[model samples]
Target: MASAPLNEVCLAALTLSIVFLTILWYKLTSNISHKEESRLPPGPRGLPIVGFLTFLRPNLHHQLTELSQHYGPIYKLWLGSKLCVVLNSPSLAKEVVRDQDSVFANRDPPIAGLVATYGGIDIGFSPYGSYWRDMRKLFVREMLSNRNLEASYSLRRHEVRKTIRNVHTKIGNLINIFELACVTKMNVVMSTMFDSNFVEKHRIDGAEFRELVVKFLQVMGKPNISDFFPMLARFDLQGIQKEMEAVLKSVDSILDPAINERMKMLSEGEIWGKGKKDFLQILLELMEQKDIEISVDLVKIKAILVDIMIGGTDTTITTIEWVMTELLNNPEIMGKVQRELKDVVGMNNIVEESHIPNLHYLDAVLKETLRLHPALPLLLPKRPSQSAVVGGYTIPKGTKVFLNVYAIHRDPQVWESPLEFQPERFLNSTNLDYAGNNMKYLPFGSGRRVCAGLPLAEKILMLILASLLHSYDWKLPEGENVDLSEEFGLVIKKSKSLFAIPTPRLPNFELYQ
Candidate 1:
């Protein structure tokens, strides 16, 4: 009788505890529901499981802009299992990029970017940490520093002049503007990274490097189904990841030998750049230095090198092509740019790098082209590190954020006639810069994650564009019209290749030599 009574008491206690726990759970869930109702950015209702995967468009930037109109500036979309936030307005973008820069500085690069960047070892995609900070510091202070650029001026000058001379030969022929720019830019990038003589020696062997860059970028920018569904990535469902690997293998074939040669040179105490080191020399020195703050291996060095090589080439070359295309499309703007060129850098002599700053109208034209055709229209996607509130909505952590600068740059509220190419709009706006400070115009993005190569890109772009406009007058190939329609990719490229004919405007052809 005594044992039976104890068992009954234990059972009654268990039932009471279960009831109490259930009441506690209900209260917690009700509070969570209330909190969720107030938070969570408004967006299109997505389907179960897949969310907005089915709604993705080929022209994502345009589609996102259109979506912003209906969903408001800050909106959310679920791509497969991923939560993506689109920041359309400058104010919204400012929150993610500026106010919460530390939280959102991390990038959510696609699989291809990861593979191309050696699994995020480079400064481009590396998390905001000691390694990234040190690498960036070294790159800015040593590699792409003003002093280093000045030291390498002759090489930049040589490559630009070489391109001019080559174009002079093909003056009457229809020149593929992007191809010309790509090759010329690549030449400069190679020389800047290594040695000019080193590039000259390896040009024949590295011919395929050009094609590899084109393919790598195509693969890097192409949308992959795997990125939306991480589970599908390993299967190579879209084949984008596989193709990127193949292109990288080819790129490695070129880079390995070149890097090995550089290593040998460093080991032999040749000091390729002497006292004024190139990127390769500086990187090699870092590897040899024992007291270096950042611990970087060969792989990290190579990844950083690739970032610089690809980043340096694509931004300048593609933007230069667009600048030419815009100038060609708008004859009035073209005349204005040429007149400014003539005034700042006379027809009596070829333009020098020093003349770049004085050509205000040309700068306006360049800026105008960028406004229309930002290299990355939706600047590289960023990922918030933790759950955060943005624009009065709770943006859950790890959500992919795309700041639609293209849309912001062309917003009707911001500009008088946003769609039309108007370089004059920027004529008096000396405060406006591409450095991401002005949210109204962030060609290079903003905040901590702003493009690491902005300084170099600015200098190279101004120099190259100024040189071309000053040295030559361009025409459409006999019976062709310029196509301003965009072909979106890693870089926003022209819908069709610009085939323009060039005629020398300089009094002395020898200046090109």
Candidate 2:
């Protein structure tokens, strides 16, 4: 009788515990259901698993803008297993890039970008962290500081003058503007990185380099099924990852020898010409220093170099081509730019960087060009570290985000004539600039991940654009017209190559030499 009573007591205790656990689980699930009832942003409900994958087009920026129209400024879409959010309005952009910048600063790099950036260690593709901060700080202070740029001025000037001479030789003949700009910009980038002597020795600005840059960018912008479905990434079905790997290897081959040579020279205690450190030397020195807070390595250095090389050459060249195209399309605008060039930089004299400051009209023209055609229309993809509320909607953790600056720049509500090529809008606006402070006009993006090379890019772009207009009088080939059609990529480019005839306008032919 005693044992029987003890067994009943044990069974009763077990039954009570099971009842308690069930109540707890029911309460937790009910709370979760209430929380998720209406939290997700409004969006289209596509077909079962693949989602909106079939509706995408090659012009991703344009397509995203269209989607924003239907779903409002902030909307979510399911692409395969991925959840993507598109931000269209300026206020929403500010919210993410400013108020929640640190939360959204991380990059969800595509497979191709991961390979191109050495597993996303470069500043462009790296995650937001101490390492990224240190790398960017080093790049800004040591590589692209005003002092460093001044030291490398001779290299930039030499290449630009050489371009002027080359164009003079091709006077009255059809000149491919893209090719001309790409070669000159590549030379400037290489010379700045490794000094002009090293660049000349390696012939780093050859056609091969040009082809590689174009292909690399094309691959970067290409959409892959692997990106949409992570499970399929390892299979390499699209070959994008493999292609990027080959490109990175080729880039490595070019940069490796130059790096080794610089390291060797540094070991022997040799100084660069006039004791001025080129980009490579400075980076190598940082790598050797043990006292610094951040550690540097060959992979990081090469990744940075690749970022500079591709970013410097491709974007600058594309912008130059677009500026030329716009000017050609609107001859009156072209005349105005030429007249300003003549007034600021005399017809008898060649253009110089010093004259750039006085060319206000030219500055307006450049702002206008980027306003219409930001090199990076989508401004690279960003991701959230954790679930957060943005624009009154909950964005779940790790959703791919695209800030459509292209659409923001062309918003009819903000601009007077959004489609027109009017440079006057930016004339006196102090707030609107490449600084990325103004949400409405972020051609180079904004926030912690804003472009680090804007200063260098501004100087080079102004110098090159001014020089081309000042030294040469350009016209479309006879019976030909300007094509405003665009072909989008990592950098937006004109579908048709600009072929223009040039005539030297300088009074002194000796300047060509």
Q: Best candidate, TM-score-wise?
A: 2
Model 2 TM-score, 2 decimals: 0.90
Question: Per-residue lDDT for 22-78 in model 1, tens only?
Answer: 554344324324575468788888765567878877677788889999999988887
lDDT of 2 at 299: 94
252-279: candidate 2 lDDT, tens digit per residue: 8888998998889889987775765578
| Worst 10 contiguous positions by lDDT, candidate 2 | 24-33
List the candidate 1 regions with Cα displacement exceeding 4 Å: 1-38, 202-204, 271-276
Candidate 1 structure lDDT = 0.81
